[model samples]
Target: MSNNKRVRLSISQKIDLLDQNATGQLNQTDLGEWAMKKFNLDQPLAQQTISNILKNAETLYSNVNVVKNSKSLKTTRYPQLDDEVEKFVADMNNSNLPVNRDSILRYVRHIAQVKCRIPGKEISFSSGWLTKLFKRIGVRSRPMHGESASVDISSENIQNELRKIEELLEPYDPVDIMNFDETGLYYQQPPRRTICSESLGGLKKSKTRLTVGLLCNSDGSYKGHPVVIGQHKSPKCFKTRANLLSMTAIGKKHEVVYHYSTNAWMTNEIFTAYVKKLDVAFGRQNRRIALLLDNASVHKIKIPLNNIKLIFLPANTTSKLQALDAGIIANFKAHFRAQQYDRALCLYISKKLDNLDVYKMDQAQAMFFLANAWLKVNPETIKNCWQHTKILAFKEKTICDFEPVEYPTSALPLEEEIVAELNGMIPDLPGNFNNEVTDVSQLNLEADESDMIVCYTANTTNNEETAEG
Candidate 1:
């Protein structure tokens, strides 16, 4: 003569029940009764329900991030297949292979047909299945490219190095712990491909490159002046305007430090000078910084400095350890490319440039765009990259909040009407435009034996010249 209602507990509530049951003070029936009363259920939970919850305690505990109202953990139809595919995706991604929705779909379909081999029936996977698979695997679509893929950094080694880094970084605030790294800037490279009026007009990839060194603190509150190294000490483009090559001309607004090398590569002398300047600047501000850098030969300079303690990452681990490589550089490149695209579109609109001419830019324009791009990189993006490296001391319970680095399609000339109007005109875009273009290439600035000898000879020559003077 009693009316009672069945109730499903949330994942969090189930975890609490498991914790209470773990005390070993109550039997299943007692625990069920206790849970019903504690959770204000209409009826005591069934003994079998309590037993099942306890049996899946580990799963419930792991799913604490599920929505508060979520009452069930749904199982996939093919858990084994899902697991294998997930692992495959992880392996491909770790190796830096291009794996996108189409690739994943092809992979899953191949597995189903060849491995599953269900008689007479073709297992079909839809967008829903792919979406679910990505959700279950806890990954999002990302554009991965560059030399980072070539470096195979072991997770175990990264963990060990992180532990050491954490201890060293403990004394400093997040805002005070800084990381610096350089990336090659293919400044003039256009999108690998773009919609044109005629058949796709692709151009040879631009080899015009500059090496840019970026530095930022863990909190991203402070961004150091970017160092832009190009092959020309005073490129012909800068000569058009007086004082154009000087940092003073670009002025305090951009705050970029311009340098030059024969090949636009970072060298020991350049890095030493850069750090010495930073050390002096920090000293002036009465600030002490624990600067994290990769163990590159160029970074091994013996610079007598105050207010800066240099912390080098373990060799070959920069791919996983360096903060800039995490996503900040990629983000910077995205912004830079967006601005580049904007310039092209503007020129095309103003009738100042024709199809292929739209992509053409002078070194001076490239420098201004690069400086603006550096300024445009979000501080939040910088902070997220630092956290993503996990070089800081913390148990990051959840996945990193960084969105996948993507080319800013908004800046691309992708307006349907515009693309439709230009349908047949041939515009030379960047080569390989089909694939995602992200710059994660942190070239090893380590000097080879020959390069080291050259650097040493150069330094000796410079010192002797100074002495003679």
Candidate 2:
């Protein structure tokens, strides 16, 4: 069978191609090779096809819509306004603020009245406009309830909580003030979007996950060993020494403490045991530290520790008040995802893997990468996240004083290298390469067990009893 395959280029890709062509850095043939590799085409793009695209480059550029990750070009009524609103919504979501129809409409009104003010002219934001805005931004209204719905995200309430945490943490040294939280890790998942045919786009995402608990000091000087929880105790990948050594060779020594539960989630028992272990460690060092915790039911401490003081943040306020939730965990996940791609690429280079279509990382492999990722998180990043919570005493700084920080993600150095190496070695890619992504704050929130399920075969259940206990 021929390895060559046909693919369709989206309007965005076409515009990007035009930009590269305009650079005059590559000839038609070379550009064809670049396009083949870039778009994951099985065969080199024909010279005539490039010429035709270049001929219609202006049309393609004009058709490119403001909607992000859109595979199709759209005719938007207000392109510039759409871009601004999308950016506003994204910033709101990234800051862990609620983004609902009311909030969006308020923003639209602000932009129309303040930013785009015109004498004797008023802009009406109709339901049709709101619907189109939501569609363009890929946002939908989801039901919110319980404590989350009742969360007082008002400025006064948030400031009061911040002041309260600041006061509680004031007496303790930065190193003695610590925050602990749990996050979900989808280790084997790929990116959510990919350059692919219509048939392959919008496929279901992988639900395989492990819960990771991270403890870090306020000063960013100390990152305690991670506590990992998974569905299985003795997974098949962990059955052999060789499998463990493979991960060790790729990353630093694995120091992660692993546990197992029925659903691989953080339970009251697991959290209490983990805390007790930390308390004992601190006691041995003669350290009396303040441990900050969220109001999760699992975070309840059944036993009192002599050396540890547990302070729980206000209900539904961890997103704004917890240091780790501010950005530390997101940065850690970025590093983890980057290492994930790095591991897959290394395997492919070693001929152990055939393609990048699907790279399955076992529990053992995930542990090593998890350790490495946590280790790679910068101390400054941790401090910055702590500052972000406004729970720490930080000097007033203007926005212009700091350059925007780029959190590490899978796309950063590895994606380009993988594409370049694969283009040279392999002529055909089996399937679309997904770049899995999700909300960083959502990872730290309590997981919905309904979406996650782990199944092991009879042969791989050897150490299940011992692991679970």
lDDT per residue for candidate 2 within 16-67, as digits (tens), equals: 7888999999998998999989988878888888888888877677766545
For model 1, residues 218-311, the per-residue Cα lDDT tens digits are 8879988788898988878888844543543267666688889999999998999999988899999999899999888899878677889888
Best by TM-score: 1
Q: Which segments of candidate 2 are over 4 A away from where they belong?
A: 1-164, 196-199, 202-204, 242-253, 347-351, 354-357, 394-469
The Cα RMSD of model 2 versus the native structure comes to: 26.6
Runs with alpha carbons beyond 4 Å of true place in candidate 1: 1-142, 145-158, 195-201, 242-250, 394-469
lDDT of 2 at 454: 26
Compared with the true structure, the alpha-carbon lDDT of candidate 2 equals 0.74
As a whole number from 0 to 100, the lDDT of residue 259 in candidate 1 is: 86
